[model samples]
Target: MTDLAALRAALQLQWALGQEILALVQREHLALTEPGQRSGSAFEFFRQRLHLLPRLEEAVAALRRHRAAWQQLSPALRRSDPEIGALLRANEDLIFRILLLDRENQQLRLRHGLLTVRAESHPHSNRSTSGQFSALA
Candidate 1:
């Protein structure tokens, strides 16, 4: 039998991590708006976020695997498990919030001229080798 309670706890923990990531993105947006208000160096901010990615991915993958197992059960079994259903709904809501915040952050970055460029686009350009500051920066 699937352990509904353990799955629910995992979902809740994932939701909490999602919330934390959203908060971090918001803080980054605020920092971009107010340069002097930045909490740390850009390297530090990126490092912290990168550190969370693997753990977050693991939790999400685990939840999906457990959910798949639970879904194999009968409808009556699913309906009787109110806590699992509620937690699943709440986790979905958290994911939506995270996506929205991430989109907003991307838009803000674009507005501020932080556009991404492909390395292949400038193959032979040696502007940096000429002892001049890069306009790209």
Candidate 2:
């Protein structure tokens, strides 16, 4: 059917776009790690590289729509097209795993940031305690 064809095209386009965005992220990450490359602050580098994640998510959502449409096809059609089913399932799994890994990485980064802030603030507490008695006079 025409609708099926359109969905397939859309899914393929979404997958290709996601791959392209991931490639760009990889390239930017590698460039940022090169020695003596004082291109920008770490936060700025991370911001630029991370900008692709939302675009990837959008592409994954589009692909999921296509996959749902494919699943709703008649049983006979699905039985006759095993490759479509397999590819759809595989891509879905891959995207889901990527998103899960991204979330875990974000959580770890947040924990690291909290630890860094705590370490930086802890020394100030010692200084404040040492001066507290003198200031109370």
The prediction achieving the highest lDDT against the true structure is: 1
How far in Å is the alpha carbon of 20 misplaced in model 2? 4.3
Report the C-alpha lDDT of model 1 over 79-131, residue by residue, as the tens digit: 87878877777776766675566556545554665434442245466532111
lDDT of 2 by residue, 27-104 (tens): 433434453644554465356435655666576666667677777789887777676666676667656554544434
The C-alpha TM-scores of every prediction are: 0.69, 0.53
- Candidate 1's displacement at residue 7, Å, is 1.4
For every candidate in turn, the CA RMSD to the true structure comes to: 8.5, 12.9
Give the range of the ten consecutive residues with the poorest summed lDDT in model 2.
Answer: 128-137
Q: List the residue pairs that clash in candidate 2.
A: none
Model 1 clashing residue pairs (backbone): none
Give the residue spans of candidate 1 off by over 4 A: 110-116, 119-137
